[model samples]
Target: MPDSLPPPTPGEELIKRIAVRVREARKSRGLPRRVLSELSGVSPRYLAQLEAGEGNISVILLQRVAGALDLKIDALLAENMPLDRDAERMAQVFSKASPDIQQQVRALLFAHSQTELRAGRICLIGLRGAGKSTLGKLAGEVLGLPFIELNKEIEAALDMPIAEVLALYGQEGYRELEAEALERVSATHDRMILAAAGGIVAEKTTYVRLLQRFHTIWLHTSPAEYMQRVRAQGDERPMEGNPAAMTQLKTLLDTRTPLYERADSQVNTSNRPVKASLKDLLRIIEKRRFLDVLDG
Candidate 1:
């Protein structure tokens, strides 16, 4: 008879849990190993070892894998609990803190989880064709705050077209540039209106940071209205004669709705004039004192 395999050490058991979580998440999403490897910049062999619970990974590597998996590390390490949005965000913040700080934060969150975090900076978040740029500019003018488009900032910082950034650096590279641009702009301007790239919510770390550092507003619009606006602007790149374009757009909106919903407030532009929408957004800012208020 073959000898029984020795029990896994405690640390090995933890590693096994993580590996199982990673493999299950990838498989559940029907993502092939090569796809995950490509998305994560991790080798297929390394991912294989990870799935088999035979390889030790560094924190940075684990973070890369988790981000590519569209999961928080805490979820990967969760103790048999199904992950939810609140759990994911909590884990994102908790995992980034020191042990002592984590304890303090736990108590604080328990005591006042409902407390709002409103920063002085105004950040607009939404999908494309939702009037983030147009509304953001108008709001900035009205509020006397400088207007910044994060995409333009990323382009200037990289000194190239965004298409080139995607070609050269990939999605991860673009996210790095996006975060850096946000920091540079936030550092330079004490109070400004920032129109973030539509997909910024997909970057967990950056999105969480934005939540902590800005008064975010989701610019909501109907899928039909969104398509109409996109066409009105002469940008049909998304459709390009695809009959299922609206379906695709709705899918994206549905997937990202939860993330966008995390904003401090929402201003719907559907069935409303741009001026009216801007006025509604301005009132939100006034209520929060987001504009013209410097951080202490």
Candidate 2:
């Protein structure tokens, strides 16, 4: 009998998987090997050998190739959770979709998924002084649901005030904490009223998760009213040592308007009493059935 070939080692199997994923991802995007090499800053010859499953590429080089192919390194390395052909094709299609179409697709998928992901969770989003805290508290009380301010959750988790957290961790660190805090909240609470920081929408991944997991309401007011309410809360920093504070505030409002508009609903609180705004907020919740979740 002819000599049988030896079985491939575990390392060899992993290299083969990586090779296939890289080649398939690159080809699906219509990227030539030379183009990929240029994008990844790895030699074309190395890429060629890697794709042929002969090269024992290092993790760093493989990471570069994965980046060039617009894939996570974990995607290439995962053994049990292999990407089926249909899913790979769908991922490519989704990557090229417009933002609006992508959002619609996400909403549709979330709606059809087995789990009630949103699960009666409601989030209020907008600039500070938009009555998120006030209305969230009031609505939670009336509806007999828990009310959570996401920043406060972060503060409690870190055992520090928000100002101290910001001072200690800087903005990037704070944002990381914010995202973690959001995840914690989502995992812990199936039904609650959440008031998120205004800037949460600036983080795309975190914001998308929030939208998918909660019925978000944009609590908005005129810039003037926003400033007035902030001052009324005994926060004088907005006007302290900033001659162009109002202008800066208006510019920020303009920049973030589109992001805030992505919320599932909006309540205008400009020139309105808290009680009246709370009524409108409650009406929106009832009219939109934000808290209703269909059983699987």
Candidate 3:
């Protein structure tokens, strides 16, 4: 008889667990390996090896895979724990639930988690020309709170400009850094005003984390004004050799409206002066008492 195979080593066992989780997640989502490869920027052959437990992927590559799957990295790495099976089933169910139900669930869960995590933190989210940077700065000064631009934080961390970061790491890498920058900001500052990139909503995991950890306000404007303001800021890329840019912008706005509506509040800046919109923002914050911390 053939000699018994040597017992699996600890590292081998860990790799097996990762392989199983990756395969299970991909299959459950009905994502073809090639599609996942495109989303994760990992080669199909690499993904194949990973799923077969014959590849040990780097953390950065693994992060890209997890983001593509809309899963937290820790979820793929955690050792067996009580109720893990039930938790996985619940997560799948939640993913299939209606948006209204998902919102209800998020409220129930985040209410407890946000009591301290979100206290006195405010985040402005919207397209580039929505006045997040200007208004966030003004409001922070008025309220005696710090103001931070999330992209600037990311740039500082990487020691490069936004364009360079994208050129170097692609969208997935930039998003991974975005998520990390957000977490760092949340951990370091309890009371600050933050301006977030408009496309943050496209990433479900990061968007959910934003909602869970800050009082978010969606700032909006008309498509015309959005374009005008962006041009005023010296960013002509939208209109540079793109005759259909306006149409594309409108379509994008329409698509992201639902996602933006998920914010806790909204402030419209259409056809309004800067000072007037600032007043509206301040009034809403006061009326909503977004900064008030309740005692346990």
Q: Please give, for residues 86-158, the per-residue lDDT of candidate 3 as tens digits.
A: 5766787988876546655655765766755576999999998999999999999999999999999999998
lDDT values, one for every candidate: 0.82, 0.87, 0.89
What is the per-residue lDDT of model 2 for residues 228-247, given as tens digits with 9 covering 90 to 100? 89999999999899989999
Off by over 4 Å in 1: 1-118, 292-296
Score residue 252 of candidate 1 by CA lDDT.
94
Model number with the top lDDT? 3
- Per-prediction tally of clashes: 0, 0, 0
Candidate 1 displacement at residue 105 in angstroms: 17
Arrange candidates by lDDT, descending: 3, 2, 1
Q: Estimate, for each residue in 204-258, the C-alpha lDDT of model 1 and write its tens digit.
A: 9889877766789999899999998998999887779799999999999999999
Q: For model 3, what is the error of residue 135's alpha carbon versus the real structure, in angstroms, after optimal superposition?
A: 0.2
Error of 2 at 214 (Å): 0.5
